[model samples]
Target: MQKKGHRDSYTTNNQKGTVAITDDTVKLPKIGHIKAKFPAKINGLIKSATVSKDPTGKYFVSLLVETIVEPLPKTHSNIGIDLGLTDFIVLSDGSKVANPKFLSKLQHKLAREQKILAKRRAVAKADQRKLSDSRNYQKQKVKVAKVYEKITNIRKDFLHKLSFNLIKNHDVIAIEDLNVKGMVKNKKLAKAISDSSWSTFTTMLNYKAEWYGKKLIKVDRWYPSSKTCSGCGHLLTKAELPLQVRSWDCPSCQQKHDRDINASINILNEGLKLATIKTVGTTGLA
Candidate 1:
């Protein structure tokens, strides 16, 4: 049987002696009160708290905060986003946000650290030293962990900022529902696809849209956004609009289209249609 990595965590409920919270500190059973920074104010009655440690050896406490948030004022502007490997996101407005491949950029550094860690592990193994008892091995392991942690933090920060901006400014946002798992099956594109982090971005858009009272529409993945001509609505066969052809003139309308931008426009239109249909159905019910 394969061994599973253990998860480090403990939970405490809101009792007089168990867990307590103040403006800038958290109190645990035997640890007493520890000073902590609050990114946002915690509202509502004291709830249960779960303290967990991540692979990076950093500790985090998750508080179940029951709070109400007022929705921001509605914005009339809407947008469509096309996720691609070349650009992180191409918006319907013709803006291309370059992909900051954090992991790719730091691959060399990570490889160097892993090399050192491997040497340490090998020495420990050759000497018949237990890995748990090898101080050097453990130290090198943490070094490797820190690199991974940095990459995760950078990607998360970028995604959160981008998602927040979209939700704050747009009334409705449209994106293709990507089959990320299936797409990653291609050996050539798997690394690029994973680095793109499309799934995480869309997930953030989904929840943030709900929290901010904005609309997030997911067009079908199989919808031929790329092959359809935005000008004349003429659909091109897969052969005519192959992946290699990045730009082309529409035969039906004779208008030139930048492949990704044109696809974003199509996505925007489809999203608007879906939003309209939903609104009509809701009004009819009311």
Candidate 2:
């Protein structure tokens, strides 16, 4: 089967003449040495390699290497992060990370590219041209694809940096178990939720936490982190806490709280509780 404008990829085993990696280039099974960029030194035995061409006409090689997972030095710091659309992440330590909003920033450019692509497709259709034979349409399609690819790369870079920072500095990283799929069903916040890419960020945190021997704790989604007071442990009713209220004062303790930061603190406390229990018995969210 073939797609009109889709990526093509293939994987090769590490058998003889299958795959070989050098300082700057990689030798594929039959495709001799190709110029490549290796961002980091490959530190392990190469197991396999997969090569693929993206819709934007860029090629990439992903090497599967087997290496010893070395843990990072302990920093003895624990942090809780609250992910949100307003700000990307709010830490329990009262630090806020602004959302990059990469897709939103490039929306106008993407719209222009999409319009051009649509016009080219229309012209090709009017001429009854096959998509594969329509040079203009294909070219415009690649332009549109490149715009999307750029946004994806920017988002991924941001996530990697943020995850690395947290994993490297913190011994325990606590975050809420977000119901991203359900959150996106809200039409008003759907775009923002999708743009934040909370799931991808959490996945990065998970794997990196493991690699660095850090604890990644996911508190239960149903926990009343936002409604509970971090200082007084007072639980506010759902009716009392609304989305519009970004800051609130605890009735019991009279302590003012930034909504996200308070929730992050609560998450951190709960995660620590879980961690304490895990040391003695089975590990669980509760």
Q: Which ten residues in a row have the lowest lDDT in candidate 1?
A: 1-10
Candidate 1: clashing residue pairs, number? 0
In order, what lDDT does every prediction score? 0.90, 0.91
Model 1 Cα displacement at 50 (Å)? 1.3
- lDDT per residue (tens digit) for residues 1-286 in model 2: 1353567887888886478878888988878899999989888888999888899888999999989988999999999888888899999999999999989999999999999988888888899998779998888889989899999999999999999999999999999999999999999999999999999999999999999899999999999999999998999998999899999999999999999999999999999998887876754433
Name every residue pair that clashes in candidate 2.
none
Point to the candidate with the largest lDDT: 2
Best by TM-score: 2
Which stretches of model 2 miss by more than 4 angstroms?
Answer: 1-4, 282-286
| Tens-digit per-residue lDDT, 210-241, candidate 1 | 98889999999998999999889999999998
Worst 10 residues of 2 by lDDT: 277-286
User: What is the model-wide C-alpha lDDT for candidate 1?
Assistant: 0.90
